[model samples]
Target: MAVEGGMKCVKYVLFCFNFISLFCGLALIAVGVVVQVSMHKTFRIMDVNASAGPIILIVVGLLTFFVAFFGCCGAWKENHCMVATFSFFLSLVVIAEIVAVVLGYIYRDKVKTMIDNNLSDMITNYKVGSAELRETLDKLQETWKCCGAQNSSDWKDYGSDGQSVPDSCCLEVKPGCGNGTMTDTAKVHQRGCSDVMSIFLKRDAQWVIIAAIVVAVLQLLGIVFACLLMRAIRGGYEVM
Candidate 1:
């Protein structure tokens, strides 16, 4: 009777955990969609290719969605095979999340430098680029209230006459804000795009890491419950 009661307890606990996993999977999918849409609007506008980070979230979410079914069914029916399958998939997900966390940390440290280099190149070639590129840079400068990649000086050679900053860098909108024999520091943003973008990237990366940690914790819990239920089911069979 003790063994039967233990098995019943384990079964319900596993069911409850798996139920939570189902919603977690859906949440991940939603997060991925939001990230993708935001990246598409900003990065895509700058002609920067979107990273695989968001896609990874969606893939992991889909995998979790399917694996959760095995866990739910196994616990409810006391099926050893189903429970074992759940354990295997859950372990894989845990491993993947760990790898992602490590990579995320490494990337976070390098993001600022990478953005600096990319923005520098973009600023140097701003005038020779497509209209879309020009418009994107203009909008970025205005929205961030920033100037060139590293400062207004980075645009020393980018003006139409090769002596001023872009009009978008102006502290206030006006005609010929970018026209002069020399850059007019008094009329333009003083900050750099590199610094502004670096702060934004760091914040976004932190959130990604937090989300991964949460998912990893939940997966670990699911694995534990699945194992406990498996043992209880095996013991009950042996007693019969």
Candidate 2:
């Protein structure tokens, strides 16, 4: 009787843990969708290559959902084999998360240089680019409150007749703000796009890293619960 009662307790506990894992999986997918949409909207016009991080997240999310489902079924049916399988898959997920965190850290370190070079090229070709490209650059400058890729002086190199900066750099919207001599710091932003964008990228990467860590912790918990339930089932509980 005591053994049966203990197994029941284990089953319920495992069920609850797997239920939480189901929601965590859904949340990961939602995060992936949000990241994909934001990245596509922000960089589509700049012709920048999209990162595969979001897609990987979505794939992991789906895997997590299925694994959790198997866990729940295993616990409910008191099936040792199914519970073992769940633990195995959950371990794989933990491994994948570790890899993702390492890759994310590396990418975060390298992204600043990539952004600087891309922004420089975009700024240099802004005048002759398509209207969509121009609009994208204007929005980026306005959003970040920055001027050229490095500094306002970067505009001088590409400027015709010493007027290269776009009006988007203006402190206030007004005519001829981008024109005339580039020396008037009062009218335009002093900070460069690279500085602003580097901060933004770092913040984004930090959030991803944090999320990956949280998910890994949750997976670890789920594995613990699944393993415990497997032991309970092996103790001779009838399969439901």
Candidate 3:
């Protein structure tokens, strides 16, 4: 009887976890879509290629949402088969994430090699040699002063590794060759934590709304599942 009751409790807990996961997955999907759309707009001024991460994020988000839907259905029904099925899907999602991380590691050296090649090209091609590069850099420093006065520290740091500076920042320089022209542009292309934070802040209100909905849904679903599973377990144990 105790074992039966414990199994019932475990089921309830799993249901609750699934419920929360469902809501979180949906929220992530929504946020991913927003981020992708925003990236499109930002890419026009920045680099369209810069959006690769968001695009992948959007796909992953959608998949998560789908998986969450299955989980929610499973929990609602208290169907062990359905819940187990959903768990299988979740496992796949975990595997995919692990694979992504591994691929990133595997390709890291290759990425670095490409960046080195680009930097070497910059040093060799120097259309105007290092002297002109130095003068251009000085001009950038002067511009930084102006930006600083305007309370924009954006100009103070030079982009590293394949990162593109906005045209506005490097407008004075030859096209395709300014602060972003450095070999480090490749490195800069990856979105930083700050970039992710900016995206979140930009959609703060939307997230708040979505979060509220998710929380409410999860809570309601969790309670319903917990009570139902508890009753089912008690009955099963009594029969034992």
Top-scoring candidate (TM-score): 2
Model 3: per-residue Cα lDDT over 162-193, one tens digit each: 34342323324354544543223322222322
Q: Roughly what TM-score does model 3 have, to 2 decimal places?
A: 0.45
- The estimated TM-scores of all candidates read 0.84, 0.86, 0.45
Clashes of 3: 9
Candidate with more favorable, higher TM-score: 1 or 2: 2
Residue 114's lDDT in candidate 3: 40
lDDT of 3 at 216: 45
Model 3 score (lDDT): 0.47
- What CA root-mean-square deviation does each model show from the true structure? 3.2, 2.7, 12.1
Tens-place lDDT per residue, model 1, 1-240, is 256565566678888888888887898899888988776545643335445667788898888888898999888888899999999999998998899899879867777677777777777678788887787788888888898877888887775566788888888867677666235667888788888878887898788789879878878987887888788777665311
Where does model 2 exceed 4 Å of error? 1-6, 41-49, 238-240
CA lDDT, every prediction? Answer: 0.78, 0.78, 0.47
How many residue pairs clash (N, CA or C atoms closer than 3 angstroms) in each of the candidate models, in the order given? 0, 0, 9
Q: What TM-score would candidate 1 get against the native?
A: 0.84
